[model samples]
Target: MFDIYNIGSLILTLSILYLSANKYHRLLKLERLENAGASPEEYNAYDKRLRLECILLIVIMGTATILSQFTNALTVAVFMIILGIILKIIINKCCPIPK
Candidate 1:
């Protein structure tokens, strides 16, 4: 049955999956920046943007979880969780990291 524990675990799984994607993006960007000898100012800007992106990501996932609660559709949440994993893999291997 749907419960707080199940919701909590879903949130945790979603967060970990997407955060790993974010980490992959960061590493790729850092390597690119280092190879290009990017300026500290550029790095600062990138960091700020990435932080904002992460905050937005968290908010979106949290909202999604909250909405799914009322609907009692853990399946939707599970789908999102699986999607996040696929996204992580795409970020790591296929898609170019955004600036």
Candidate 2:
């Protein structure tokens, strides 16, 4: 009932916090890349991609929160977070970093 909505709202709030922390981490990465003499074009492209991912994360989290209203709160939150982590892993793969 109302608890479900509360949980969903909590999940949404956490998602925003997670996104902010992630953006800060990426900004640090960007600074390091710049210090390493990465080209302006490359840096700009990476920044653009990060911005797009942030936008998409906001949309997805919002949608999931709304959908949670008609579903089980705990299950919806767990699934959305799991899926987001998997996506983050995939994006990490694209970065050429060893797993």
Candidate 3:
């Protein structure tokens, strides 16, 4: 059966994963910048942004996961796992660790 709920679930899961990973990378980069002697004000601004991003991602993930409950449990679970791996690849490509 072609379930729209499943599709939506997949999309939301993938999006949340990507955004979360990207935010994490940004946080890491901010830390690197701080260690590289960024101004305290600049670091504080970046830190606040990172924290806001984390909170937003959490809300998005929570909402999406709740909505995903309408879909088949097993399907959602499997697709989520696959999407998570893909998200990892995207994170690596888009946000490599600072040297």
Q: Candidate 1: which stretches are off by over 4 Å? A: 72-99
Number of the top TM-score candidate = 1
Task: Give the worst 10-residue stretch by lDDT in candidate 2.
Answer: 90-99
Ordered list by TM-score, greatest first = 1, 2, 3
Q: What is the lDDT of residue 40 in candidate 1?
A: 73
> Which 10 consecutive positions of candidate 1 have the poorest summed lDDT?
90-99
RMSD of 2: 5.2
Q: What is candidate 2's lDDT per residue for 1-99, written digit by digit as tens?
A: 546668677777968797888789889989998999888777876776677567557766776776676878888788778878876776656643221
Instruction: Write down the TM-score of every candidate.
Output: 0.63, 0.59, 0.42
Candidate 3, residues 61-91, lDDT tens digits: the string is 5544654666776766776566556655654
Candidate 3, position 3, lDDT: 65
Q: What are the lDDT figures for the candidates, one per model?
A: 0.70, 0.73, 0.64
**TM-score of the candidate numbered 1?**
0.63
Q: How many pairs collide in each candidate, listed in order?
A: 0, 0, 0
